[model samples]
Target chain A: MKRGSLYTLAYAAVLGLVCALTLSAVDGFTATRKAANARAEEVRNILTVLGVPVDADAAPQELLRVFEDNVTEEERGTRTFYSYEHSAKGFLRAVRFGGPGLWGRVEGFLCFEEDMRTISAVTFYRQEETPGLGGEISSSAFTDQFEGLSAVGPDGSPGIRVVGDGADDINEVDAISGATMTSDKVEDMLNRTLEEMIGRDGFDG
Target chain B: MARADKQACATCGKGVCDGKGVVTFKDGVWHINPVAVQVLGICSALAVTNRLENSLVMGAALIFVTVGSNLFVSLLRNITPRRIRMIAEVAIIATFVIVFDQVLKAYYWEMSKQLGPYVGLIITNCIVMGRAEAFALSNRPMVSMVDGLANGLGYAAVLAIIGFFRELIGTGGLFGHQLLSEAWYTPNQLAVLAPGAFIALGFLIAIFNAISGANREEGSQR
Candidate 1:
């Protein structure tokens, strides 16, 4: 049947209203759980990078509890540091860092050992890089290279390098083979964060 | 209608006078399978099939969206104005997709992250919209739902097959389990990348066509 303009407009308005209501109901139902999941993920990353042993299967509440009991969140100016005292590694500090990536923002935590200059671990908890190429930044093959490496360069500058070739320097790590732009962006972000971290008043490198 | 169509109609329940449920199911699942037969919705098929779990979840999401949208569209089919029907169908489809995405994010946070925007992209997946337009608009709600379910399953089945091979060959594992020992079998890294999806899908389509072609010839002879 042919429908007039008035009927079509009314039908469209009604359909739009119905969809909006349905979406609003679903959003309301999931808002709490989504927030908890996001919080738990952030806490999980912070704990993992700080070398604090939390169960991989821990629930959001459990992760939050572990994070609260073992870790201290200290705010220094604009930066927030998550510090943990491990039974084995002694003391560790992790800070959140992020920068514009090739596709979107890439964010992660940079953890440091007791000496403040030596790296303990790194985790790219949030990134939107290409799945197999730039996305490898989150994989252990890439992030594991940060362990025991220095955040300071050979010239005493507070920076790290993601080199394409073999990393021979104390602060350099190998870049992902086919992801030069991502690697460079990662390097730039790490250096920017590192500069603020080590060059600041509290840190003595 | 033909005598065979009349006979089929007699067997159907009320409001399903055409007895298209079984036919729709058969068409969606196998005869005109969404992914394998029609080659529709290949983007998610390729993007998520690198892992078995990812493929399954993605498939489930599609199934939910398609079925829900089809049911809603069919229910409103008669009253839906011809001019705004497409817009109405889209609104219903997007609602279901967002609902699935939200629930997935809340309960299965890890899988939600793995699937990423692909789950949200279900709104644009042609299988859901195609069924809503081609079948649901003209069909009863029950048959429309069956069509949705069948197409979703057909798509999911193809995805599972592709995922199974890609994971096993690419990483020498199924669902992240080590089936092929590193000492004996070296994983083909290509199978884990995007190109692997195209290769796997191409092979699957070829195999599907060969079998179906042979079946058609046999039926013709009979």
Candidate 2:
């Protein structure tokens, strides 16, 4: 049977309305849980960077509790710092850093040991680089290289280097092969954050 | 004709167990598998098959979307206007896809991050739309659901196989567990790249075609 134009229009309207309602209901139902999960993920990243012990399988609430009990959050000069007092390592500080990546914004936490120049850990919790290439920045193989590296160059510049070739400098780490653009962007962003951190006084204490 | 049988089955309500249902199941899972045979929805198959976990989750997502959309489409098949049917189908399919995506983001945040936009891209996967247009529009709701499940399984099975080989060869592991010792086996980097998906899928389709071709020959002779 042929459908009249009126019937077609009505059918379209009804279907569109139903679909909209369904999506809205689903979005409403999941909004709270999704927010909690996102918050938990951020907390997990902060805790991991600050050298605080975190359960790998901790729930959202559990992770928040750990963050509260161990890490203290303070805002200083537009940058929020997460500080943890480690018995062996002394005071550790972690600050959020973000900038333009190859595809989108690359964001992560950069932590420092008590000395303020010694790297503690780096975690690229958010990035949109090419998988298997630039995407490796988030992988432990890449991030682990930052551990024990100095934020200051041998020349006393307040930045680290992401070298394309083998890293031979005290402040340089090997950039991911075949991801030159992403490497350069990450280098710029890290340096930008490092420069700002170093220029500020009283941070070392 | 198949069309006649479909109309009869739609009215009979016994289509699920009748010979038609068995044929539909076989056709979907093996004879005309979505990925292996028809080659529909290969985009997600390639993107997610790099890891077994991602592939399985993607497959589950497709299964959920297809089954849900097919049931709704079949139920409204009669009243749905032909001119607006495609739009209606898309609206229905998109709803299911978003629901799955939202739930994944809420409950399985890590996996959701791994999948990224691929879960949202399920809205454009032709397999879901094709099944709705071709089978659900004609068959009974129950039979259409069976068809959806079968097709989903077909897609999922192919993805799992590809994922298994890719992860094993690429990373010397399965589901992130190290299976091959680094001392003995060096991971083939190519297997983890985009090209690796093409090579694995190509081999899978060839093997499937060869076996099905042989089966057809034996059946004709019998």
Which one wins on DockQ?
A: 1
Tens-place lDDT digits, model 1, residues B1-222: 235544655676445625567787888888998887788999999999999999999989999998899999988988898777888988999999999999999999999998989998999999999999999998778788999999999999999999999999999999888999999999998997999999999999989977765235454652
TM-score of chain A of each: 0.92, 0.90
**What tens-digit string does per-residue lDDT give for candidate 1 at A62-167?**
9999999999999999889999997877789999999999999999999998778988899998898998899999999999999999999899988999998899
Candidate 1 residue A160 Cα shift, in angstroms, is: 1.9
Fill in the DockQ of model 2: 0.79
Ten-residue segment with the worst summed lDDT in candidate 1 chain B? Answer: B213-222
Query: Which ranges in model 2 have alpha carbons more than 4 Å from their true place?
Result: A165-168, A201-205, B1-19, B214-222
List each candidate's DockQ score. 0.81, 0.79
Q: Which prediction has the highest TM-score against the true structure? A: 1
Model 1: DockQ score: 0.81
Task: In angstroms, give how far residue B99 of model 2 lies from its true place.
Answer: 1.0
